[model samples]
Target: MLTATKMFMIVFTLLSIIKSVTLSACDEQEILDISDGELLPNGDVVFDGVVYENRDYFINNVTGIKTACPKLVINKCCPFGTGYKTRQCVNITDSFDAPVWDRYKLIEGARAREMFRFRIGKINCTRPYARVLVSQIGQLDWSDNWHLKSDGKLFVELDSSIPPWTVQPPDKYCIDTFVYEDQDGKTHTRLDALACFLDETPPNHFEVRSTCMLLSCAFILITVAVYAWLPELRNMHGRVLMAYLLCLFVGFILMASMQIMLTIDNITPHICVVLTIVIYFALESAFFWLNVMSFDIWWTFSGKGGMTSKKMSKRFCAYSLYAFGVPTILTIILTSLEFSGLPPHPLLPMVRYQGCFLFGRSKLLYLYGPMFFLCLANIVFFIMTALRIARIKHETEMLKSKESAMHDQHRKDKQRLLLYLKLFTVMGINWILEVISALYPDADYIWCFTDVYNVLIGVTIFIIFVCKRKIFRLIKKRIKENFTNSKNNSEELKYKRTIPTRLCEDSQHQRGSVETIRTTIGMENGVTAEANTTIL
Candidate 1:
């Protein structure tokens, strides 16, 4: 009995020794050493991870525990506490012993509660113009918002969608995606709004401008539809109007889309570049088309009814190329300068690094300069057109005693001339305002007027060209035909109803009396002084 008891004691002692050695080996593999690490420009570090070379024990992003922590720690040794682990948001320049990095930095006290989760702590960087990021478990998560705290206050939300967010030397702001509750939500005192305003700058004016551009887009679309829907209205005048509206339609669309896209988080530079080029081409084409209209009108009024239909067609084709081609070439040159960064002129204030900005004096020199010349040239054309109409009027007055076909044709020409004038005035005035405003950047009142005018360009066009008697007549004519067709269908349905189910069964058999049935159906469908009785 004594020998058996001694053997049992010896085996239990051996088991205890094996268990202690196994746990010690696991502990040796879990922790990593952070000494002699090098810092990167973007808040990343390069370390051998020699302290806990075995990755099974160290988790990334510091979000949670590894598979070995809970099963082996005996007393929940993860995070090691106080003297064990040091984790915080630190600046590259900050020393390991910096008190600010630890004071403002976060420690997840709640991490002790959840065995599988680490309470992510937040930190405030002290470095000026530093490249910062929101890392998820030591990995870059660009989508995460950098909730910056300045003196423990909420700063302006910086976007990760843009290129690296950095404040200019004089200004201070962080690029962050979301607003943090812990930080009071206030836009940083020195936020340079222009940094994030690449697609549409002057953030305060964005809503007003976008509203106007979107409305203009809607109006231009309607005008284009009017020209397309009625083939009969595809005459020379109508075709020119359609072309003008189409250009305006495209330009307004780009303006509206850009305004909204600038607010988005992740917009590419190439997309902005394309939008800028297209908008320039479209607006230029619109301006030239306006010039073409004025010239066409002058030609018509100046002729003694010598403008033949074939000649009109030829002129339209030639003018279209002139109008579209000029803008195309100008756009190509401007685009090359923009893409290659070889511009001869100084870049716009906000456009130095911002993609696709065009609201500067330099862009006006290349792009808007041609438009200004077109506007000036068209003004002379308008004057010539007016003089021709006056001469025609004088001739009509001299022949006032006689009403000849020539006089009637002159009267029609006068009406057309006036229509073109109204169209020109409506379209040209807004552009004029734009130019004047550009010249006098300090002119607040002029800009306000221009803002309202540019948006209402489409409405003005609709009233001048689309609300006319001829266009209205076409609309009413289509509506009338549709009404008649629908009325006939309803009458047939009524007749069918009147003919009982028994008669409907014999409808095929009544083919011999088709005419009589038609007359009966019409009588039943038509309303009169008294209700008509149909005998079928």
Candidate 2:
């Protein structure tokens, strides 16, 4: 009985030793027996050899044991062209590649929450490729699955249907395609693309090309409108209005051309981009000229001339033409030089958009340089004009008390000047506000609001000033008729009272004789006085 008991003890001790060895081996293998439907870290679970990189997991919402496992594997697959068959059984422990071992290390660390992800490259399987994973353990599982078949390959099906990647056939393929990995370890396939295409459909090309032609036609029409309506617009400070309209027309034409050129995908030749830049400068020049015209009007009418013999009208006309003409000619020359590749002209390269835009250091010199000058010019002219108007007003007030008729004439002149000044002031303020808003577009909301206000004011001014002449005439006629009636009533009241019959008859006869002589003398005297006044 003692011998049997001893033998049983020995067997029991051996069984215990074997069980411990089996447990240690399982630990070494890192076999993760995760349950189904359990959301691991990143909405995935470790199973077999597939590493599931979660694409849409929010780390903050996870809890419990799943929280500890920040990265879980959902699928395992070998690299591309792997011919491994059979889905479930795989032994990757002894035959795994070095990269696979490295990947396993990353997974172990991730499982310990020490790292966020792992990347393994060049694992030698049927088709070897680099892979990214949420954990190194997940990568090991994938390798194990890859080695499941004797062919040493793994096939991992995508959880989502792969999108069909298409390109405009080879003839139209100006761009290239690239593969990129996202943070979630998923690969994103993209076709290299540009903002626009050179060989767009005929309709699209036509539409783009027609934009400039249409705008050019519109400008032509606006010029016609200005010419035909000049007489009417003239009364309401028409010259400046015409300038503004012309600037708008030219600006639209240039802008449309630039936009059309920019839309073509790959045909932005350096010449074309340069032309666009030139056109942009031309448009800017036109805008500045418009501002200059406004300033001229302000200076002319703002009472700045006072009684000074400045020949302001002729000077203004000459200066305006020179102002517009000089810049226009210079811009044309510069643009021609740039396009013709002349010396001293900057050479720009063609870029992704076909033509380079105003970018880099050249942009500041080329684009903002003119703008700075324009702003300075506007400031100088505006202040000078305002001061002149104040001086004229003071002079007019001083002259008013000494001479009634002269004062009335002065008042009419002042009214006319004020009308023009007001018009130009509106334009000057609008331009200044627009420039300021452009400089600090993000800081204030006033720019947008003021632009809308300016449009409304422009339309309102046109209506008010253009229709004012007729309204004023009608008012004057009504006032004249009222004054004439009042005068007649006062004369009738004086004549209706007291006249003696006898004296009236006798006086009538004497008065008739005397009236004839008096009338003849009065008529001769009146004719002589009128002739003398006319001669004088």
Candidate 3:
């Protein structure tokens, strides 16, 4: 009785009901398994209602474009003056974001979750090439240092010091890197996740830098030895030179340690904070003393109210205090600012980075500012000193035939003036150039030469002070004394032995002779015989 359309609709409805029932009964045992909510492959435990495996909330949540960074919640306070691991590998705009360069991608998404929760400024560098490993929530299994694999994927090796934790943070994170083809001029560096461990073998250039500093350290030691061995070189100039060398020695040593041992993760924490001060003291002392030296030479050449060497010698204590005290005050101010926990007034962003190395930004002003000015002063003084020397040269030439003594005196003055110029070149000018290189870090071309010069300045100092004829004379004198000392002692021994034997022979002849010889040997050596006569 119904139309054809009505008959077709009834048949279709019955078939749909049968298909729905069949699909619903497919997984009868596990429809809503409420015993455990869900088991995430990444080991995250979720108790909320949504059953079965769901990738949206865990894996895909973090794996998506970084535009959806999790809300930042400050759960802990980071202290200053300590070295910390580089947990926050940042890219742009004041947060740890992946670099947007190089159409590159991070390989493992799971370990990236662990990297994000890493705390800053928290490791001690007990060994070289060490790594700071992090663990899961429920177990003590650790994630070792990350490295670039042969195929360009960053592989974070997993090490288990204890049984693996059943639950862990949502794993899998990555940074997209942008690299450039070297053949083309458009260059770009893809700074990916910084390796958390100090490389056992640093890059080739780092080795050269290390070698340069080491060589300089050795040369500075030679200079120190020369100064210590030769008392004559302990004049005002020599003393200042020694102070500068000492500062560089320590500074370079710290620098070398940083180059060899530290990374973002394996920080040289609490101890490095104090050593940082020592490093500052070394640099500041060197700079302050170099300025004092330049001023002294300039005044000597000016000849108006200029103190003689004897007079300048009296100011050594005052100069020492000025050189050391000023730096101490600045260091104290910086330390207070660092721990204040307020907006970093001038500590620089490096304070937030690895501990103790770039501890503060104020160093640029408090440290480098004075250094720049001092270098400037030294340059002016060097010119003034040189001109004064030229005038003396002309005057001496005019009076050479007439006044032989004055001519010889002026010649000696000229030599001393020349030495000052060499010192200025080595200590003042070279350091100024090095500072300039630091200011413009992008200028790699200039850095190469300046780096070498700064590192080798100790060698220059040794050549100027220790390798000179005066130092040579003192060294030769010491050597001659060492060889002659034994001979002189042997001669004295021979004289004593022969004289004693001769006296003994004479003493046998008479009691008077024995008494006289006993008296010559002294009462301490005289022996009384039974015959009531002294025996020698």
Candidate 4:
């Protein structure tokens, strides 16, 4: 398991790097056109001879029109850059001059049309005039500048003028452009440069979907790391957590890759996403089984094994079936339905752009279905454990007063049992908090608080279990030493009293023995004297 976890971590890291690189590339490529110049069709002119002092000029040549008339009032507004301005024609010129004006007309059946026109006149021209006209008939209409239209339509007009003559469009000519004044009170025109009109195409939905999937995957990795590294999380709990995280990781990867593939017009993205969701559901169901295992430990220790065992056995078998069998069956059904023009959801129909997983309503199944069942299972386990603890506590207290050896043993047993109960009770509370947080993703603060709770519980248990024996030994040694010292003191006091008294008694008895011997001898002498006197 450790090896597998390490390998998974390595893989996750590599995938993260790849995802970051891919995202950066995508961001860089997001803007379609980067050139500063306005993009136009084939017939657009770039004039170098026209001298403009401070005014700006923008011409639309596709419509065979010019607006350089003195009465043709033009105002310029800048939209994007400082160099150019958006210009609009307020009036039309009365006189028409061809020498000072350059016109590019749209040809019939022409594939490309010029986008801009400029006026250039000689010094000694006979009819020195400037007239810009808007033609109605053309294959391409530069007059319909799509960039300037409020409703995303194509419309164009002449705007700013320079020294001799500068084409200037009015400020209100286009809704998209704006004008700004400098510190010197000099006004500058800004024009919204026309983006290259390729085709009206939507972005690849798969790419966006894939990016979202990558985010989800990153979250899963974080979950995995927490489960693996946190000592508070037990083996069984870690396993369950890892399983769920892995399921999510796989699902997100498939979802993301599917989106990318779909964006690139690949056919396998849909199949992958469906398969992933099914697998995720299976794993989620298995997580419930793992929860059952944890609850079973509590149940057995709490002496509520009979019913809990039965229920857990059935649940274990059911979970196995769901974890392996259900996903396989679902995959087959969904795959068949996908190809049969009878998909489960319209958003996932035929695996088209509209039918992708990101756009699919079937996502609700993946998001909420497994979560509902898991939450229910967690609640059931928590309630069972709590009830068992309550029952055991009641039983312990009931038998505490029994005046028998058996009852004494029972009391000790109950103490140990109660200790275990307290430990598991803490665990149960943590698990409950975790389940609640999982159900409510927005409650991250609650989840973090639960982490601290779990850590404290774990530290408390470690101090109890790991350091308890040493502590008890130290206490026992201290008690034994104290007892021994007390016993020695008592013995010394007893010996002190008895030894002097015993020596005094022994001396008195010896004195008595000596007196008795002396008395006997004296009597013998007296008798001898009496015998002698009688003999005389």
- Candidate 3 residue-wise lDDT, 500-524, digit = tens: 7888877777867766666655645
Error of 3 at 470 (Å): 4.5
* Per-residue accuracy of model 1 over 1-536 as CA lDDT, tens digit each: 56988988787566545544544566656543333444345433334311122322332224433223322111111111211112222222211110111112333442212222121222223433232332321234323322222222212224433322322211222221221222465422111111112223223465677788888788878888887888777777778878988998888888777766766433566666678778889988988998888888777777746657897788789989998999999888777666574533354322334344465475667657887788788889889988877776777665464567777766766776677778778876876787687688656778678768876788887777689898899988878887999999999999888789768668856764775556666667784323332332
Clashes of 3: 16
Writing each residue's lDDT as its tens digit, candidate 2 over 442-500 gives: 44465455535444443544543444665457556656877899999888866675446
Arrange candidates, best TM-score first. 3, 1, 2, 4
**Model 3, which residues run further than 4 Å from truth?**
1-208, 263-267, 304-313, 345-356, 359-363, 391-406, 428-433, 440-451, 512-536
Worst 10 residues of 1 by lDDT: 94-103
> Using Cα atoms with residue i matched to residue i, what is each candidate's TM-score against the true structure?
0.53, 0.37, 0.54, 0.30
**What do the candidate models score in CA lDDT, each in turn?**
0.57, 0.43, 0.54, 0.43
RMSD of each: 25.0, 21.5, 19.3, 27.2
Candidate 2, after superposition: displacement of residue 254 in Å? 3.7
Q: Which is better, 1 or 3, measured by TM-score?
A: 3
Off by over 4 Å in 4: 1-241, 256-319, 343-353, 358-360, 365-367, 397-536
Q: What's the true lDDT of residue 425 in model 2?
A: 60
- Model 2 error, position 26 (Å): 46
Evaluate model 2: give its TM-score.
0.37
Please, what are the lDDT tens digits per residue for candidate 4 over residues 389-431? Answer: 5665587655556786645644554454454455446545755
